[model samples]
Target: MHHEAFVTATFKNLKPNDVEFRMSRSSPGRYALHEFMKNVYDLKVTDGNGNALDVSRPDPYSWKVNHHDGTIKVSYILFGNMGDGTYSQIDETHAHLNMPATFMYMPNLQNQGIEVTFNVRDDLKWKVATQLKHVDGNTYYAKDLQYFMDSPTEISNYSVRSFDVDGQTINFVLHHNGTEAELDAYFEKVKKIVLQEQKVYGELPSYDYGTYTFLACYVLNASGDGMEHRNSTIITSTTSLANGGMDGNIGTVAHEFFHCWNVERIRPQSLEPFKFDQVNMSGELWFAEGFTSYFDDLSLCRAGLISQEAYIKGLIGTFNYVWNSPGRQFFNPIEMSYQAPFVDAARSVDPVNRVNTFVSYYSYGSMLGLALDLSLRENGLNLDDFMKMMWTRFGKHEQPYTVTDLHNTLNAYAGKDFGDYFFNHYIYKNEMPDMKRLLNNVGVSLTQDQNNVSFGATIVHGIISQNTIMGSSAYKAGLDNGDKIIKIGDTVINDSVDVNSIWNTYQPNDQVPIVFERFGKTQETTVVLQASNVYNLSLFETNNLALDKKKQKMRDAWLQTKK
Candidate 1:
């Protein structure tokens, strides 16, 4: 029943005037504005002599302390009940601490070193797992505010597994309801993914503290999230490892670990020194996040954790999602990256159609990654080489990079003209690359499922919701997006009814009686079903003898694991 916790920060060497203390409006991995100060209350401030200080709150996120001595102590109580990689929670079981959501800092002293000490309850047995350098029994050290905020602390008596690679120790701290055997098996797959990702970059990045921690909280009540840090990551999920949830968990682990190089170290120029008070938007997240998405599944296939068929199925799913999204006609990958602050975990009380003009940077970027990889392969190069080059030029040196840096690297390796053309069409403009042609070169077939019939409307909530009528049969039948489909040929629509399966029984051009409810009025119409020209991409059967030698060589090279 412990729903609240207290935090006290003591500031020394203050300016002896008004100093502003603030909780972050947004966090690093989280693109949405959280307004963390909303959950904080009972703020108290005092001087070194224990005299109350004059505090003025200019805004909800900041508090201005006036009439303070050179040293001041500020304390507040925080209320948190939800647990994820981005939010903090304190309960009877454990304390999940996200620095940005739990700690308040002075904007002026952001570059100063910080030391944090935890006062563990004597009755509770909790162990600490974080990337922060340990000073002694209960204290930890961080070089700067950016480093401190990126580190998430998990104080729980969890099971731990350790492995070493390239002179660095990787620790997996798990607090979940899973057996030891299941945990060990999952760790083995994680090790393989780590090895494969390291191989792509040619080497692991220089860890700041010579250790990387995977702080995972897999509980039935926790929300799913995985946030990448400088030397570690926080992955929380409601799924149990003993069940069928390990595969999805592995995908998140691989994705965040890949970000250790892509977003954490490679560094977007706009987000280098992260802004806590405002949204930090970058145009290169197409590579920072999207390319990482591309490798998340590819690494699994390379690790032998998933089959080639399964991997291709995943790719086809992405292709279907991105290609079908209407936003592609209006926004490119770079534009979508810029839209992340508005769409990533965003919520709105009013209805505005985002489906018409919002493509996920993650999905679109992965599609671009696939297209570029195959395109580069046509020129005797691969995406792996490009990543390694970026690691050397920007990531290894810890230099902040921009879209221009990416273009320059691509031009240097794949020719100036080709790079210009690729960026112009795929990144600058809303033009998708020739996926069919690119995939064909690798012995894969990208085709559309023409046999599938649909009413040409995307339905939701067991009703024909907004944005449903997209020039399909439903649109032609005078049924708008807000028209709720109540019945189809006298068969009443309900939660159990599979709308697609119902339409599958009929063919294109077949007229069917449809009844819908719209704005408190019942309407009837006849909809002529149309073929859903959805892309269904798959690799050609490799087990047979009809495969071409050159195509087989290409596929082999594409799927080969680097050592």
Candidate 2:
């Protein structure tokens, strides 16, 4: 339907003859350029006395009112349809507003206090929910533009669930077509995640207003995402709580909540003062986002909401993804993190060779986190203590930390030698730790399926879906992305053909003739089958071996609940 939010920015007491009102090009919790100005239209500037004023655009995102009365009311229509953490959406069902996407503000008045009153749709029985301080009616107050922009609002006929933990209130507001029973069930697990994450840092961040809100819009029209703020987070998805969303979307809730401690308070120096007018890139995203990703599922396991098998299985994806990546040959963790501006939800029409050139900071850092945690456990310590130390020295004091601070802190907590080795080899050099030995300390065995045949390209309907991995069998055969194999040896590849079954008939080091389509031309080549590079992770007892007391105790201590 027609999705739009009418905004009226009333600016008064102008210090000079002109005022610049701008729509933010960036938002918090993300590292991409959104250019929110594109969605704003029908802009009309007028005086407080209801007289039209002269407005000029000096830049694409800014509107300058020159030689005008001090009082100016800038009104515009913000057309938003994508309901996620970074954008806004308004419809007859609800008005989900992420601040930067819905509001315009005076450039010089960032430090000035602000108040907004949401004129809700009484016909739909809509109400306002936000992290901003409630004034009266449907109005709210923010200390400054920074706080104002950070506070996202949801207006709908939503349900609320609240609980007090450590004298701080946690609110869960759900906008969905689900039953109250479903909400109650979901909130119960949310409580477990909250308490378990709290156990990690030994406490919660002192929320600015003694409350933290989870603004969740699970309507069919919403997009899927989770973004963390100082005292709140916005989690939107198209999946309803009754439709497998309870299991699927809970991970995002856990992930965003952890950020209140890690990225939000345990501040990264590069993102200390978040920029609104430009893209913000930080080299510590490997630690900022990746480490939080590690804790997201780990928290679920520690809370007993998920089984140990599922938790261990979760490690396989990030582990193989990070370890198998060829991007490490070029960029270290810090350098890989610098790619956030290009990869963090950045939009482009051109094709990119990301498969071979890039590794996600999320997966890269998460595997590193797994490695560091296991390594720390080997030294009779744990990652939890290191995080706690981080909170005490940096987060609690609100001192923004750099990469060196992280290294020095690890050195102080683990040891000079241990920290130096982790940083020099793993962090700075893009090398991986001995994860196999570290995981084996807890009775999990890591092995490679080298005896099996390997074809390192994903094929769907006789077409290669992605770029072939370097050094893989397909790559050795000169196969690249978009090559459609018509026949491999005697097996004709098609929609009905199973590539795996064909590969099963072959042995490692076997060579076969292949015919494929490339750029509208048929080609012939001989492909040499290589040893499978697949890595398998299994528990010692799963392989019919009993864990020793030492390893069993270590596993229990690592996975068990703190309290």
Candidate 3:
């Protein structure tokens, strides 16, 4: 049987399943992005002998080609009785690809293959860029199936820029509507942070650690946020660029870029093989997203983008964000990532309840990461050493690392039962982390009081548990992780609620009555707030000012900074 391939993709005003196609084979294949385009994309084929062959929808997601002499009918159901919004083909103003037929892979009888590229429409609102080599006009080449699968070239009207950071080529793209200066500043600052991070690890990885940022402007309404990929990240927020905006997004960029070392390379076993068709579930997301979260602000501070005070403030922010959520009682980081599909879907339906049930792999993960680092320090090791060991053993690998790989490598690096230390808290336990104690060991104190019944515990939040402080008291109060604490006693809660709130209000010896809630469960507690032994963010500061400076010096050294 002679095998040949010819491919063409087009869109019409008609619904997706209405188009037609003629083929020389009994079956042809197709691939589509269901997330962006949802419809019954139908296809039919005929042989050269003028015979209509049997075509089965074995894989609805995959395209099929069939042998035929007559035209093969290929179409899909776009809009039903419900109107297809104004964003239809020809009628749409922007040049967004109606269908994601960007990369087509054709394999020979020998099991080898070639990738075919599509010429995306060039308009002012759109700019096309990809890792694929440009063959000529509208055509590009992918080295293999992997590249073809990963490459999504059409970044419609999203922010974009190209930069070279410390001889490492980098790209920064913002939402087109965002201010150019803002993006430029972010790129410059983050590049510096990446460079500083690399210096500590010794050598840099490959020069082509390509990075891109996509801002959705209004992600899922005003609920804009960001997520990371191997070489790119998607960030969206309502903060306009023209209004001198987007200070919050800076930490996000730092967090995502750092993933190049963690999840992208030095990853866990479950995450080694990415199952794009279904779920890429992992129990080690705490290590990936959590540690990345801890280091995100640290990287910024090390690069001098933020002051030490600001760095601690950032950590406090994470503490508050995580502690206020109520999901700790229902789920942990590992379980959350594993049940991501259901959890994410549930979030879309009932966001409040979702947070109550599901914990964030990133937030709790980072907390665990800090705990692990402190534990290592307690055991005579440090995070820097772990980072270097990870880089030397796993990160330098040409292929992806697995959970087993990460575990084995970490065990080898630490030379002990590090697994139990990590998995117990981050994966298995629904218990609160000893963040206050851990911070104290590192010379920072975490203190809290609601009423006469006062206690110190690591506080975190749940998705459905909104409105309150984050950390020990917040966690024990059965509150959601991202709760916004409104009022305490007679005072209204502002941006943050923690020991500092108590400090700013009542004197050290003053007894105060506190009222707070979890998922709107209002409770009252009376307790005497204690004067901090350590500075805020410092778990173990001295009773005097001079000793605090000495501890600060040590903290500076830990951050590899000049005192």
The C-alpha TM-scores of every prediction are 0.96, 0.98, 0.66
lDDT of each: 0.86, 0.91, 0.50
Candidate 2: regions farther than 4 A off:
none
- For residues 1-563, could you state the per-residue lDDT of candidate 3 as single tens digits? 01111234331232223222221110000111123223223333344334555655444344444443334433333321111111112112222121222212222211233334543436444555554556776676655544444443433465666666545666665543555676676667766766766765665566333434332332222324444444544444555544534456567667767766776667666653443344455666677667888788777778887776566656775676566566677666667666544543222444444434666677777766777777676566777677777887877674556556666666787774775556554556766657765565556656554333322332333122343323334344544444444455566664454644444655555655556564566766654544433323533433232336644555655554422
Which scores greater on lDDT, model 2 or model 3?
A: 2
On residues 294-372, what C-alpha lDDT tens digit does candidate 2 reach at each position? 9999999888888877788778877787888878888999999999989888889988878888999998998889899
lDDT of 1 by residue, 118-193 (tens): 8765466788888999999989999999989889999877888999998988889998878888889989999999
Instruction: Quote the positional error of residue 195 for candidate 3 in Å.
Output: 1.1
Query: What TM-score would you give candidate 2 relative to the actual structure?
Result: 0.98
Find the candidate with the highest TM-score and give its number.
Answer: 2
Off by over 4 Å in 3: 1-126, 154-167, 178-183, 207-225, 244-246, 320-326, 329-332, 345-353, 378-380, 402-404, 417-433, 452-550, 560-563
For model 2, give the 10-residue run with minimal summed lDDT. Answer: 63-72
